[model samples]
Target chain A: MIQAISASDYLQPVHDGAALPPLEAALKNLCRERFRRIDRFIQLALLGSARCVAGRTLQPDCGIYLGSGLGPIGNNILTQQQLIRDAEIPKPVNFVNTLGSSAGFHVARNLGLRGQNFFISRRGASLQAVLGAAMADLTHGVVGQALVGVVEEVTLPLGEHRLRQHLPEDRTLAEGSHWFVLQPGTGDSRSLDLKRFAEFATLEDFLKSVWRTGDRLCCARSMETHAAKTMQRGFDAGALSGPTSAFHDSLEAAWLAAFAVSREPGTLFLVDGHPERGWSLFYLGA
Target chain B: MAGAYIRGVGLSCALGEDAESGVSAMQRRQVRPVVLRLDEFDEPLQMPYYRIPDRAELFDAGRLERLLPPVARAAVAQAGLTPEEIHRLPLFIGSSCFSIGLSESRYAAALAHQSETAIPMPLCGYQDIAAILQRALACRGDTYTYNTACTASANALLGALRMIELGWYRHALVVGAEWANRTTLAGFSGLQIVADALRPFDAARKGIVLGEGIGAVVLSAETDSANRLRVIGGASNCDTWSVTTANTNGKSVAAVLNQALEQTHLRPRQVRGIKAHGTATPAGDTAEALGIRQVFAGLPPLSVLKPYLGHTLGACGINELILFAGALQRSFLPATPGFETPDPALGVQPIITPEAAPDGHYLLNHFGFGGNNTVLVLEKTAP
Candidate 1:
């Protein structure tokens, strides 16, 4: 079993015609040194990861598994505009930061970690992807600790951002950086476990056996509607909802991080996957 | 834990469309890089690029759709998996340019037609490649897309290998793809590292020549009678020295190399040969060479593959792996085509001629941007 020792959830809703609130001051306070040539995506990664690891001494070999839906969107937009629209080559820093792993690099450097660093993406379910990868490494004894983070940046000009994502015109937007520190073995912290079932019936049976009085359930937004509805009906402890007023690509991270930070009394089961493919239940126990 | 076997392989690069033909062309030392001139900028950029021989426009928006599926299909077909196994097969994709070409084309067209409301990135997300492959192959299993620059695909393979070792799945399809896009080309050019030729480990080496390729491998827990190559294990670590390059000191590189060897329970002398990262840049080769020397007292036969297929960045990890594995199956190690003079400062020289690839262990090195370094250990048993 893996344990979730700490978590940081930073979700900021962006008004239609407003600019993103500045993160410089918070980042300066969290980071060890001033980092140059970093874009907003990297800043968000540093912010969330540092905040999660704050007031704690991490193992030097703690691995970093960073996930994102639209990775480094701000830097990518600038680079694409420079190359395609302006007919100019991108600057070196901009080009280098265009990579998703660049953010992981900064996070590793900031925290004095030199362990395994990975940047994995699965669009809407990036949290599951990175968390699964990190848990695997922990289970295999590859690293003693894992720092997993999912960051999504919101660029200016809400209209263009919405168009880029193919969302509705009036759909509210938000930026978020959700982080969790996971470790193997049992401890006083909340225990995290992942269970896979080939069929929905099996998953439901497993959840039924472990359901507590105040335990909550959350069906992934990407889960099939009928299956989600069925799971929702089975659990009476209320469903964990994401920020309804705004959106980011990986809403699952928001839901999971909120629950992790809530200091709640009962277990939270987050179920995902299609009925045909398989079912995955991420259990976070109190 | 048992390692996963390389059951099937497919590749499309500058040499040829199939793995066998690409390896054959490489063994014959066929070095070809077409001159690519981009006149969009004020200073028209010209560089030699090793593109796949598809006869399509380099920047065609639909080129990836046309090029990627066949390569994946070829691997899955070679694996000869059952319909059920194929349906449940997980996908691990690695790439630096995922749907960026399509995004570029759309944004450019929008700019040309309606500049007033044009958006820079019309398509935003890294799931397009996985979605395309899933649709083409009719598989809806889990997907993990990695974007760690050059080490992307190598890390993807490592992830799949560990999961397979843990008995998570019977089989996994790992793909490394990079298609031609203005962002990669123009971005590398702007870094001022685009070289005329890839002369890895040579004293006169300047920088890297960019290339693009699509390579896929089907890894299974059980090996068939014909399977000879098995991905034993690997290690990856970050180099806090610099994000753009590994530390010239080679401590970080050496650390990862030692970590991989220690994890696999192998000593320096047991390694049969080494596939150097060999980007040909001054600092890249220095770091790799110094790292190898730090790990091994007597250097093993080294092979640098970028001469035949230009540095395929993120894809080079798997692309080169397929080519090297194919050569091992044929009982010959590939030669470095561009190594004319060795650098004394680095104390390394790649084999100028093909050598016998004995049945033993080998290490594949992959270093990328963001200070990522990965080393994969492969073993070949007698068929």
Candidate 2:
């Protein structure tokens, strides 16, 4: 059952810097409008992922396989700068935050949900691992629910014109977090199911593939237009929804649909296609 | 987790450039923890380490952009490819200290008031290392760097194996490197963990003399063939213990190793050999040996690599694995270097000299800070 329900997100234009604490209120208001801020935006999206549960119980078993192409790279640089400024010793919290578990620690701290927290750091296989982890946990009954996400923030220097000039052409090169909460179910639980998922050696094969069929589909957090169009079967109205200056906008799309579903259970589809690895598919349903 | 395969391997260290030389040194039982004489740090501690010594002399400018750059470069280089190749070509890189040499240079300058306002740096810019690897290999598959002290490289290996079994990527490269840095001196000085000399599992073992080395491996699913070290499965778990000290009770380490064995669906008795994390410090060695005895009470013969090369920190996992693979290839197990007598403190007989054991399920174990204790089960390929 791999289908997108409805998607919603908060005012992401606000940076994680000085402007964050104030928006915490605006974030709370969105939960009614279909948004929730558990603590950090990282957890907020993860909390949104809890929407995958199609039942009445408030919670489900959660196993998270969080990935990042660059991770909190900007924050990592900032923390590194702080440590570098002093030669004698490093600040304790700064050192702890620099570890790979930085984001995983935030999600666990904010939600107090302890299932399996893995930070898969490979570039393309990131989503593959996240989706793959959920599937494995699903088989073993590891948890009642699972939240998988990709969260990343950048440092000012990394965003500076000097650095952008240094990057390659293929990379999306942005900052943001996208997450989904996948609740386990058997049978045709997905509003739409992922029929075929394979990695193509060449770009031509990826371009010729199909994603949508006989319905209006919106792709979030990707540049999968060529493929999505093929899936629409020429019915049209299949559009990509986000170039939200965030790496994980697809996560927002998943949550936004959950909020929209309060009116009626709707169907939206989300796909994340990294340049190297193929694509990750999730079956979501009401 | 099911079994994973190791298709290719790479290594860079003091003993030799490739696995063959490193293993030959081990078989001969000749180990020399290199002396650290870098004039940059404030502390003038006479430290002995297992380092290439002059890594600056080793790395030229354009090596990163080459194809199949000798085995050393292949560690990080091979992971760059397309969806078809990328599936089987994931990447995991671990370094105990990537540029401790640079860290030492900066620290040394700052100490001697030579650096002025020049800020000493570790890796100077983070992108330099990965960028070179990325530029050279061009395989945009899955790549990650793990720096969990001594367990760093093993964690990378564990991650690569887990992702593959989960069907994330079909293949992977786990690479580890260490640096000759001022921090190594300060770190060991601060803790007094370094021993008078390099001795592992020896009755008179004093402390660990920090060392530097680097290693890399290309692991893939095309195994059960000749040229593959079958990684059946592994488990990575936290001890939830103090950062500096391992749990004296050895409960978590025991649990972690057992979990890895369980993941491989292998009984404890099926494990034919072990490559222990014998760091040689009184607490560290006793702790690990006890953890080992807990799992394999009437255990198979155990071997430690620390005596061969000073602990390479994050690079230790790959370093140990290379030696283990080499020993298996040569049909001989290297003596646990400097291990003369089994410590009565912990009732265990560390393999003191080279010996042969049936090649079957070999367990590679590693432990690190933040309570990371990981173990892997490797089944030697049938010739």
Candidate 3:
């Protein structure tokens, strides 16, 4: 078992059919004051998150696991023209962004990670996949400290599709990027005991085992199935209420979980609730 | 590190439409990589690619309906696996562009206002490969589709290995299917990347060629009597210098190979004929040459499979591995069909004539445009 030394989250919302908000608007919302292109918004959120978590950790070998939704936003547009014009596939310049694990590469390279990086993209199971891969990489000595985040960049495809599909209003293209640093159990001076990293075959199991007695559950898209299951059990709003978009949404959970610290920290819990292929993940606060 | 086993395989390309048919021809050194005949976007290029037997065979119900929408049905069927079998294993589908081919055609059709005549689901639509699997196999277990340009399937295989290693699942179903589409042809045509049909590692190669079809295999931890090939090891790495182009120096490519070697706990000499992802493009051939040299240095003779299988983006990993193992077992490496002269830029040499099979394991490497490289080590197992 490992301990998350520190954690921080950043969220950027992409509305449907609207051009991107100003790079300034994207930057100003962040706890950090860094500026870059709107396209690099996910990377920026990750940078701030990694800094927040790593600042308290002492581990030297750190890696990153990124969960995301809609994958890389720009890649869609990059290949859009190719699709529109009926052109032969140009050299696939936009292919790089499609990599779910490589999202960490941006943060790692920016931070000179020069160590280990993995991008786990499991559509609805993004969070579960990332946390599992990150924790596994750490335990297996794949790296020392792991910086993880889930980011979602909404584009016309996500929102317009919801509209086209007539899904739900609040469910429209949600976005967030969450990151945390996990150190070896003894690496950091902080003490928080994690119960067990658990998985589920369905959302019902998650709610019964973890959220049966809880309220105000903070969830990302990865928590959808379980989120739905909990909602059915009178947990709260369904998938429409919580995080929208990529593994990036894990950031929103980190933010809410951090805020719960002053309340005796009964149990900082994370669970998928309802995953597409019957995959859900849970993490505990020691 | 963990191992996954390969069971039930599928292949389709310029060479043949099914595994049995294609492997039969490949075993005897009979393959014809053809330069497609189409418009400039379909503009006929002079590149050689594994012959696509006949597009009609792809539709011939006598043997075709056996395949499904986009190409999923065909692939799964060729594997001789039923929905029951697929539902039991995790599904990983790898492809560069799932169905850009049909999608492009439909886009043009819709553009021309030929709505009624348009293909209902332009390959990219729900009915393509992804939907087909979810529909046909009713596969609900950890289904993922990987799109990493050329190395799509290879990278997908990497995920299967990781999942298996983590003990998350005992069995995985990997699918790599490449079929002709207008976009694939256009992409290569636009960049002029297609060589006169891949003469990989050959001196006179101008570029690589494109092929299509499906490659499906079941990987399991328990290699019972059904196990055909054991996945000794697999690795994926990003060069990170250029998103669309390989870093050229091949540092990342070599690093992945070293990592795979370390995991499989096999030395360089343990591998025999290497299955080179020789797309046979100018930069591609060179990068691969340098990568091989970096990893093997004075290693075993390299055999090229693109000549028979062509390039099956998502399917290349499983597709090539299928043929490579069969060819090695048969002791016949297909000739460098169109190779007339060698390029100076290329680093290592490719086997010119079919050499007798040596006793040892083999290495297979595939590199995609987006800096993704995957290498698999396969050891011949006794029956």
Candidate 4:
């Protein structure tokens, strides 16, 4: 019942003043008045979702499921800094954007989606969790269609913290948005299906029980060392982007889900594990 | 499949520590206003906040860790679930600022010391509330955290109910915790939504008085005479008209309310009463009043609980659920506190007098920031 009809993503690498792509024209075309108050994160989310829908007339009950690691952190930190430094009053616009799910609201508002839209914070596996929830809803027929997405904005505060830990210097902290349109598929062979998804309390349990017969294993570099070692030995390891993220992992899974139809029947094993959130394994393909 | 029933509930607020005590104190209308004089604010702002009175050691890093676990334990114990059952229990928690009070302090301390003390990981990113609670309660089932501002815990409950209906889990624990923080205080103060006193659904209503505490519920597929109340159904949606405020036209909220009734197969007349999300903000109350009037032909005896418990924000979903469910179980409808005169323009009136609980159903509405609106319908079964 969890049919993944199509998927798409919008990614960007870190650079000097590499701002979010200009979505104003496209957003304005969708809804001019509501686009005025959207923040960078929301703009990113709308763009990703817009690309996925591709002008397809959607049902009013389309659910918007968005996930973020540091949701609107850039703006949140900036607002907090202004409050601390200048003793300035908190702006209602800035405060609203800081709610983590602001983008979900903006997207729903712009798209005229009246279904359930939620924004959950799951550090490294936010989008996966969001996708999992969407699949549950779709399989149960709670929603006609669900637009699942993840947006993260790498902020200076987060970068400074990462630097302090001396983890990966050129870790390539980036901002990106990835969205997938999940709904019941017609008799289209091009459609990619979500085979299974499981959440484990520990990496050990996840590795021991994750699906094996797959064309490749896709995951973030920093997901888990032991599991990565085992995956490398067992399957064709398809390393996600070096600048690892839940958004990136989801994009990779979507790619694999879409690409699976071009070749012989096979599976794509995706494992995403976080220090605090344990492990999530997703099997996407035929 | 057995319906998901509220086996036990635990809440800590201005009312009391546990649900039974909190419900009792809420019925008695016991309130203590919390005054705020933070470094960010020039004047000492006075607002009605329902903080746990017994724990007056000021906000600190460990406030949530200290306040939440006991409530979780109490709910689990009240449900008569053994430690083994708890260990295998799935948990879903909602929070607007999960451990932000602690994270902010850590960031401040690092600044003071001028030391790169590896910016406490939780501060750099989101705190996994499920992981924190799992460690606290020693439970290991699937966990999720919903963060849709005020409707956070309501979504948590909705998610748990879906999983239970799917036969994925037999029992689930839903928790909501939100403590007052400088950012929220300043943000509301700047928006001019903070009222000097908590006055929900009143003619001269001010804005919300932010409160803090934790609320938890143990939902199980099994039901005994002790806890037979069933979670009938619910619906949640985004207004998308506004981010900070709901649509004054009331179309979006009314749609969601109508959806809840449709899904539950109950008419407005069948609904015994409604727990309005009367935050007392001008736009909020106006929209809610209009929404309720549009959905219910004859407005059920409305009760606003925020005046008694204060607005717990994200925690309001679970906190208010526990409080209202407890009253319904006792067949007692607590009168809407702090409602003296109805605003004529609002066009809806609440039951100012206490009444008996209707044997059919009750609806609870929790509308939140970013136009996130959630409504839950709880059905009362015969004993």
Candidate 5:
């Protein structure tokens, strides 16, 4: 078991064809020059991770597990265009940013750490898979600490084709970055345990076993149908209405869950689901 | 860490369709250049690559659907596993191009305002490699796909090892598949790294020949088994000095090598051989050479597979790893066929002639863009 030490999120509402979220001052605070030419997916990931380790002492041995719905899609499109249309050579930054793992290196360089860095792309389940892997690594003593995170950028091809395929129109195309520190321990009385289920037979079976009677439910918009029905069935639910209630992606759902858990000190079940990818249920708080 | 044995390995590359034949060709120093005709270019662009023969027809069925399943099935069969067992075993896959070859053509069709309905659903995402493999192999367990440039599949192996060590799963299948695509070809062409011939670790080495192949390995936690090679330990780290290139000093690369050795509880002298990730690129060769020297006082007999297999990119991790294990079992190290004169700057010489396989552990390295570096220690245990 591992404790969630800290959590940070950098989310932006992206309209259908909006450009990638502008790099905020938080990202500029750490490594402004380094963030210049990189794509927006990378910028969001680093910005969120920077906030995650903000006031805390940096752990050089900490690993980074980044999950992206579409790895470097923006840069991939740009590089493809340059090669086909302009017949121009790819710039150094364009080539580098086009790689899938570039964001992990960017975060690690800014944080000045050297440890295992893994970048996985699982489309809808990217965040869930990364978090599960992070918890397993921490439980196995793979590292002293880990920055487990996810970043998704609303590029035209990605937002229209990939994200919109699964998400309903009400949800809108979303992009954000979320990061948390995973450390070994039960932490405190209010710390919620993190467990990875290889295969879950049903959400009800999972809830009946671990969830307390008063545990609140938080979920991504993708899970609205099932989650709504489950909540209506009256199974330990709360916080359906709040300021941070509108969440489109897994990162936003996780960020809101973390924030709610920290403030209220109660159960916050963050559920993210995709038919093709399966379900990721995060039990937060005590 | 818990012990993970390489119970089975499967491969389909330029050398051969199976591990044994690929190893045989390597030992025999067979050389060939497979070519892919890019229809996108106007003036007949036939890019040279290490492509599997007669797989283009399979691409018509589906790109990843063609390459991934056969290799995965072969690996599972060699492991003496059934479809029922595979349904329970989680999958960890890595690839730089997961059917991107098919996607490129579809994207072009879309760009030309053609009907996008012709594109298959499987070609849409990189995760399709795992998805297709899972359905084909009856593996419904958890799946993870790593895409860290060239080091992708190596990192996937590391993940499988760590998870098995944590007792998360008793067995996991690690698979890697990269196919030749116009986008990747254009990308590398723009970088100007494609060499006329691959001459890894050679003084006159030019650059790299892009290749495409698929490789798979079945890893089980059961020790005291009859597997020939076992994954003892490994490490992966990134150098932030550059994204497209390695840190010139090779400090991070050296650290990862030391880390793998330390974790495996082995000394430099204990390792009998090394499989260098010699891409034949000038900067890549230099960094790897320096890193190897820093780890071992007198480097063990080293070999470069890229000369024989070409640079398979993401798939090279599993492809080269399986071939290495096969070569050791055959009691012969494949010669670096193109190596004539060693670069004095590297201060190391690759095994230009095939040599008798030494019994012990071997160090395997795979470095990629964004400075992702991985080193694995594999022990050749007596059956």
Candidate 6:
């Protein structure tokens, strides 16, 4: 079992015509030193990770598993513009920050960690991907402590952003950085477990045994409609719904992190998979 | 530790289109890099590039569609997996340039005609490669796409190995792909690191020659009778010293090397040969050399592969691995073609001629931007 000791969620809805709110003050207060040659994505990552740590001493070997759907989009956009639109080579700092791992590098340096650092992506399901990878490492004893995070940056000019993502014109947008510090063993903190079942019947049976009065259930967006409906009907507790007014590439992270930071009374059972590919249930005990 | 067997392999790079041909071309010491000139910039940019031998346009959007599938199919075919097994096979993909070339083409076209509605990034996400593979192979299993610079694929392989060791799955497909893109080319040129030739560990080494490759390997928990290579354990760590390069002091490099060696339960003398990252940049070679020296008293036969295939960046991890494993299977180690003069400051040298590759363990070093360092261990036995 893995324990979720701390969580930090910085999610703000971005108005269609307004500029992104400044992060300089928040970052200045949170960061150890002024970091130059950094972009917005790196800033968000550092802010979330530092907030999650909250001055608590972390193990030197804590692994960092950072997940994203559209990684470092702001810096990438600027870099691409520099190369194609302006007909000039990208600046060194902009080019180096284009890689997704650059954010993880800053987080590691800030926390004084020298363990496994990975930047993984799976589009809409990036949270599940990174969470699974971190849990696997924790289970296999690769790292006793894992710092897992999922960040999605909203680029300016809402029209362009929406066009890039192929979303509807009026779809509301938001930027988010959700982080969690996970470790092995159960304690007073919330316990997280991942279970896999090859058949729907097996999954239903397992959920039936673990179901409680106030436990909530959330079906991943990728889950088949009929399967999701079936699971929703089986669980008496209310279904957990994601943010309806705002959008990000990895909405699952928002749902999970919201639940983690909430005062929910029971476990949140998150179901994800396909009938042909088997089922995965991420159990977060309250 | 019980490691995963390397069941199948496929590669496409400057050396050749397929794995066997690539190893054969390397054994014959073929080092070729075409001069690439980009005139679209304010100042005309020219550099040496090692591209795949395909006759298509370098920036053709359809290049990835045509190239990635065949390489993946070749690996799956060689594995001889059943229909059911292939359907549930997990995918672990690593790449630095994932569909950015496609994005650039779309944006540039938009700018040419529809400048009013043009967007800088029309397609922004890292799932293009994975989605393409899934559609081509008809697999819907879990996918993990890594973007950790040059060490991307090595870390992907480590993820697969650990999951398989934990009995999570019977088989997994790991792919490392780097395709040509203006962003990568111009970006490296802007860093002032693209050199005329890759001279790793040589005194006159200036910088790296960027290249592109697409390589895939199928790993299984069980080994067949013909399997001779197994991916043992590996380790990855962050330097925290510099994001653009590893600490030139080599302490962080030495730490990761020691961590990998300790995890694999092998001493310095036990490793048969070493495949250095060998980007040929002064600081990169210095860090790798000093780290290797700190770990091993008597240096093993070192091989630098970037000379033959060019620096494939993120894809070099698996591209070089397949080449090295193929040489081991053939009972010989590859030679470093660009090592004419060794640097005394580094106190290391690569083998100038091919040597016997005995059945033993070997380490492959991979370092990338963002302070990422990874070392993979491979064991060879008589087939």
**Tens-digit lDDT string for candidate 1 (A15-79):** 97677989999988999999987899999999999999996888988999999999999999999
**Of 3 and 4, the candidate ranking higher by lDDT:** 4
Candidate 4 CA-lDDT value: 0.73
DockQ for every prediction shown = 0.88, 0.13, 0.23, 0.43, 0.45, 0.88
Please report how far candidate 3 places residue A276 from its true position, in Å.
11
A-chain TM-score of every model: 0.97, 0.59, 0.65, 0.76, 0.79, 0.97
Q: Of the pair 2 and 4, which is ahead by lDDT? A: 4
Lowest lDDT sum, 10 consecutive residues, model 4 chain B, at: B115-124
State the C-alpha lDDT per candidate. Answer: 0.92, 0.55, 0.58, 0.73, 0.75, 0.92
Better of 1 and 5 by TM-score: 1
Give a tens-digit lDDT track for model 4, residues B1-383.
Answer: 63489988888887888889888886776667666666545654545466677654656667777777889988898889977778778787788877556655666666567644424323544545666788888886656678889999998898888878776668899999887676677777778898877667688998888887789899998888766488877998888777776798888889999989987888888999898888988889988988888887877888888877788888899999998898888887777777788788888877777789968888999988877899998988788
The candidate with the higher TM-score, 3 or 5, is: 5
- Looking at model 6, residue A87 earns an lDDT score of 93
lDDT of 5 at A165: 45
Q: After superposition, how far is residue B336 of candidate 4 from its true place, in Å?
A: 1.1
TM-score of chain B of each: 0.99, 0.87, 0.85, 0.95, 0.94, 0.99
Summarize candidate 3's per-residue lDDT along B1-383 as a digit string, tens digits.
Answer: 45776655666665566666677777666757655554444444445445456645321222322343324444455445555556655677677655455545555666578644333222221114555666666775655566566776776676676667777666677777666654456556656666665677667677767777677776666665634457777665556465445557767667777877886788886777688888777677777777777877576877777777677765788788777766655656555445557666766777767777655677888877645677888876655
- TM-score each candidate: 0.99, 0.72, 0.78, 0.89, 0.90, 0.99
| Candidate scoring better on lDDT of 4 and 6 | 6
Query: Can you list the residue pairs that collide in candidate 4?
Result: none
What's model 3's interface RMSD, roughly to a tenth of an angstrom?
A: 5.3
**Candidate 1 runs further than 4 Å off:** A239-242
In angstroms, how far off is B324's CA in candidate 6? 0.5
Evaluated on CA atoms against the true complex, candidate 4 attains a DockQ of 0.43
Model 2 error, position B70 (Å): 2.3
